[model samples]
Target: MKILIVGNGARESALGVKLQEDKRISKIFFAKGNATTDNIGQNYFESDIVSLRNLAIQENIDLTIVGPEAPLVDGIVDDFRKHDLKIFGATARCAKLEGSKAYSKKFMQTYNIKTAKAQVFEAYHDAIAYVKNHDYPLVIKASGLAGGKGVVVCEDVLEANATIHKFMIDRIYGDAGIQLVIEDFLEGYEVSIIAFSNGQKLFPCIPAKDYKKAGKGETGANTGGMGSAAPSPEWTAENQIDFEKNILEPTIFGLQEKNLNFRGFIFFGLMVTKNGCYLLEYNMRLGDPETQVLMALLENNLVDTIESCLNGDDVELKFSDKKAVCLVICSGGYPQNYETGFEIKGTDKVEHSTLLFAGASREAKRIVTSGGRVLSLVATGDSFDEARDKVYADALPIHFDYAYYRDDIGKF
Candidate 1:
């Protein structure tokens, strides 16, 4: 079977690696994939990416799997369906779950989905007025897309005012901040729950925790993801019920009831506290660093799973018993201004770890950095400590100028 992968990131690279592991998959194609993906699959729809429907038909790809939100939110799935192409992901209308935070907050409220109390603002001054009356320590978020740097945690009114200006006044994130969600801050440890849905049934993967803070001990600004570990050792049976009642069930029901043509993956960003599991946000696609660990621990046929979900059959995801850990190596000043184009070295020396490249490009014979959040290193073993040790050990040789990686991942 021939497959088409979308976007340019380690998540797509990991998907390419998993798809290749299945003997049934004959070939793989990528549309604007990263340099790392260049080594894994063939690039398709290189230039005429605007007409994806025509491109998919020209290539005759059996399965088109999207790995990013931009194309998916751009309505690639809806367009593919217009031409009878089999693709996986949410449609443009349903992608509001991730594309527009204001829409998602309203949807959550309409469906009674347990989440933080928040106020939406369209005008800059209106948001400022609300923040002035409200207390500090609130979460300020861009209503539209801002990659992953749109959300900011304000500790005082001073910081909240500054964030308001950065998003709405300065247009730091462009139209993404034109509308914003000023939410009440919920105190808890953050965790991610990823699931596969076909607009009818839901299959949950083993819970994974992603480190969003750029530094160790959860300090510093939030990056896309620093590292992640699978099976959330503390995820209990009771917790599943709480999540189902408050998040998963309501989310699926809301999708079905609202007639949102959502397929593929669903990422639930949650805050777990004594009160209950509260929904923090949602990603219509898979999580980045989390995908690395999930793919490493998966022992079943990923292609079959995708096919089954597309066909709307109740399916259970199977994973390896061993634990997996993924640590990201990024440019020095990531989630901010950072340098690129530096030739990377020592990648060949890594042993017992799977290194997925992101924000990198190939120059003649050498791999060079092209964006921040460069490469992801994944390792799996019988225990978390074993996997964490292997990740750090394998990361030693893989070096590039101004490469920054957290010293502590999975140390909690």
Candidate 2:
């Protein structure tokens, strides 16, 4: 089967690698793939949804898998299906779960899903007034897509006012911050639970915990993700039962109740507290750094798993009895101002790890950093300590101008 993957990131590279495990896959095509993905499959350097649809038809692509939320939000799946092209992703309406925080919060409330109590606002004054009246450390979120940087934890009214101005007044994130959700902060460990759905049943992958902060010790602004580990130690069997009963089942039921035929990945961002697990947010596709490690632990053929879901069959996801860690190497001053085009070195020297590229591009005869989060160095072992040791050791030799990474990953 010929497959086409949309988006340019390490997640796409990891997906390409996993799909290659299925010998039935004859060829893989990537639309605007990054530097590493170019080595895995054909890179188109094109991201326009309609253009990709045309390319799929031209290539007679048997299946298309999306690796980012933007294309899904832009209705790429709808466009593909309109041309009788098979693609695995959520429809535009369903993608609203990730595209709009206000819409997602409302859906959660309407469906009786467990999440933080919050108020949505469209005006700056209303938001500021609400913040002033609320306590410190409130979570402020942009309503639309912000590439994982729109959410901020304001410690006081001063910071809250600044964030409000930046998001609503300054329009820092464009119209993505036109509206916002200010929810009461929940204290707990955050985890990602991703499930494959066929608009009916759900097949869940192993849980993962991602470090969102740009710096070590959880300080600084949130970027896409700095590092992550699979089979989160914070998750327990009891948590799984509670998650399925209250979070997973209700979510699938809600989608069906609302006539939302979502046939793709559903990422449940949860805050597991002493009380229980509370849904934080939903992502339409796989989580990044998390995907790098999850793919390493996945024992089943990725292509077959996706095909099973598309075929409306009972799908069982499998994982190895190992711990996987992913440490992202990023350009300095990331999630803000950062320079690119620096030649990266020592990638070929990495040992005992799987290198997945993101934010990198092939320049002439060399590969160079082209975005904030450059790439991920992943390793799997019998335990988190082993995985961490291997990944960190492998990351030592890789270098780029102003490259940095969080030192504490898989330590919690």
Candidate 3:
């Protein structure tokens, strides 16, 4: 059967690789795919997902998997359903889980899901005053989409006030800055749990821990992501249970209670503290680097797993015992100002790892940089350290003029 996948990032490239592994799939088509994906299947760049939807209907594509949050949040799934075309993703209503931090926080409270104590604010001056009155070190979040750069952890009232001005007064995050969620910061280890849902049964993938800090040693401002390792060492058995009891189960119930009809992947950002697992945030779709590593660890037929979930069939996901690690090569000055269109080199030399292109495209038979996060190098080994080492080794060959990567991913 022919399959259509949405997106043009490393996550879509990785998904293309895994989706092709399913015995039932005969052809794979990508919507606006990148250079790495071009090698795996056909890339459609004529228009946008709407054109892809028309193509899917014309070709009678069996299934479509969405890889990004923007389309999902924009009601692509709803549109596809209106045409009677099968697509995998949450509807616009369900997308509020990630589209608005305030909505998600309220949902957590409505369901009694444990999370940071927070309040939402619309006025910039009011938010600044709240920060001044509050104690030091609070989490300030822009309520809308910022491609993961909207949240700031302020260490002092001074820093908090500055960040507040950056978001509220300066409008750094654009429309995403119109509102903010100021919450009490919790100290703990952060782990992300990705799960497949059919608006009913939930299938959790192997836990992955993402390093959000821009620089090594957890310094600098937060970017989309640096790197990640699967089966995070910080995920203890006790916390897993707490997550299921307090966060996971309650989340599913709340979604169903709202008649959200949410289908597709959900990412639960959790912080395991001395008290318990606190739901940090909700991402309506899979995490980027998280998807890169998780795909490496996935041992099941990806098509069957997703189709089964979509059809509401009893399905259990299979995963490899081997450890998986992903290293992201980014353009210099990324998560900020960065130039693209530079010719890249050394990717052909990478042999031991799976190279998935993110911010890159082919120009005149040459692979060139195209986005902020350029590529994802993933490898599996007997252990996390070994896998991380292999990924770094493979990353040495792929070079761009302003490429920079963190050296300490998966390092405890």
In angstroms, the error of model 2 at 29 is 0.9
lDDT winner, 2 or 3: 2
Query: What are the per-residue Cα lDDT tens digits for candidate 1 across 112-202?
Result: 9999999899998888888896866899999998988899999988899999999988999999999999999998888888898876877
lDDT digits (tens) for residues 1-412 of candidate 2 = 9999998888998998888788888888998999887888899977999789889989999999998999999999999999999999999999999999999999999988889999999999999899997987899999999999999998999999999999999999999999999999999989998889876877889999999999888889999999999999889999998888888888888998898876799899999988899999999999998898899999888777888889888887889989999999999999999999999999989978999999999988899999999999889999999999998998999999999999999887
Which segments of candidate 2 are over 4 A away from where they belong? Answer: none
RMSD of each: 1.3, 0.9, 1.2
- For lDDT, the strongest prediction is 2
TM-score of 2: 0.99
lDDT of 1: 0.87
Error of 1 at 93 (Å): 0.9
lDDT tens readout by residue for model 3, 1-412:
9999888888999999888777777888888899988888889885366787899998889998888888888888999999999988899999889999999999999999999899999998888889887876799999999999998989999899888888888899888988999999998889999999876878899899898998988889899889999989778889888999999989889988998866799999998889999999999898998999999998888877888888887678889899988899999999899999999999889888988998999998899999999999999999988998898889887788989999999777
lDDT, residue 319, candidate 2: 92
* Leading candidate by TM-score: 2
